[model samples]
Target: MKENSTFAPKANALQDYQFTIIVPVYNEEENLPRVEKELLAYTKIASKKTGILFVNDGSKDNSQALIEETCTRNEGFNYISFKENRGLSAAIKAGFDHVETPLLGYIDSDLQTAPEDFNLLLEKIGEYDLVTGVRANRKDKFVKNMSSKIANGIRRAFTNDGMDDTGCPLKVIKTAYAKRIPMFKGLHRFLPAMILLQNGKVLQVPVQHFPRIAGKAKFGVWNRLLGPLMDCFAYLWMKKKYINYEIKSKGC
Candidate 1:
């Protein structure tokens, strides 16, 4: 394990911090090295205590091996591997189940969203239970972009979460609120809405986006469009039946 350092190399100064970035990856062998490098660089510059957790979503490739190798070489990097191929939501839920820090964050393994922008989300963690990035200028294909726009519109109309880009993978959430969310297949798409159910505040910030430099996109038309449509109805049903309350009196 890498010793947790309190001193920054650039400033040679000590600081207080506590947060974890959970990266759910599926067959991302080609991008692991770069991901490790960028995350390490970000951790060094981060103003808080930071660590990286890679959740292997039952990748059939050598992703698990590479994840172990990277963690072995990097002190701040840790990981958990699933036995079978669960979806992104399951991976994220596992991350939340295990995270012990005050704040939790996530980013995609494809490198489309910059890891450094996590600092942008972290800046507002104190004011919001969840802070997510809205891709400023997306570089995805027209179909993907269009589908996401329509899906987000439908999601907003139904859930009324008022978030413009729920698909953006970069997010920093307070661990307590994150752990309370119910896990489901497409629940990752409804994070902001789920947070709102907990009476938690969510803030969206403009973050940088880039064209994918490596690997193929995991989403298809069905997963991005049809899947979200069905999930929306599921969310509506849950929202209507959901229960919340406050205790006015208690005896100890």
Candidate 2:
């Protein structure tokens, strides 16, 4: 586990929180304001009692201050800050570990995925342990789109998860199942596969995608290409050694 140096949460924040959306921020200072606005609007119209958890992955910019300010004024918003950059998977894992709500969601701070579309995924959450978005007509550069396509194709052949766009940032998962997943580096790309390892059902729904309005993309061609290839081998190894069991009966 990475060091979580700061845990700034409102007292009793989760008491009435039915869902917590984990927003992983890494040097996205330029986009925090809009992120706050979009998320605030989503909270107002979300079907469930929703809260926002911004995981600051040791951002080396003003992102920390912005996240603190956003969480301070927002009633249901909170944050966990790491001592150093821990990447997206660690941030999501931290969110899963700290979430007190029954349902947990995840999105990127880049705002390429709309927060409002979460409702579309939530609609089917009752039937599946995890419901993720499949970006419809992604608005990204040709290199990025092609690399992501190749990566996703390789992952499907390896894991056979049947997810069209695992890289889509929008997702909703039952906290119980999410918490059980043993997260590792690049595990963010394998949420559905990891849920399947727990014998949980996963589904994908088409969602809106937008071009990044601010800040630069974090991943490049190598990260999108070689990264998933290495992670696929990691998943295979994890699947082989993974332990899962069900207790038919328990004594209280």
Model 1: CA > 4 A from native: 1-17
Error of 2 at 221 (Å): 0.8
How badly does each model clash, as a count of residue pairs? 2, 0
Tens digits of per-residue lDDT for model 1, 1-252: 012111112221112338888999899998988998999899898868798888888899989888888877776678878877888988898889877788989999998999889888989989899999999989999998999999899889989899999999999999999988887889799999999998999999999999988877899889888899999988988888777777999999
- Report, for every candidate in turn, its global Cα lDDT versus the true structure: 0.86, 0.93
What is the overall TM-score of model 2 with all chains considered together?
0.98
Candidate 2 segments whose C-alpha is farther than 4 A from its true place: none
The TM-score of predicted model 1 comes to 0.91
TM-score versus the correct structure, for each prediction: 0.91, 0.98
Worst 10 residues of 2 by lDDT: 1-10
Winner by lDDT: 2
RMSD of each: 6.0, 0.9
Give the distance in Å from residue 76's predicted Cα in candidate 2 to where it truly belongs.
0.2
Error of 2 at 21 (Å): 0.2
lDDT over C-alpha atoms for residue 181 of model 1: 87
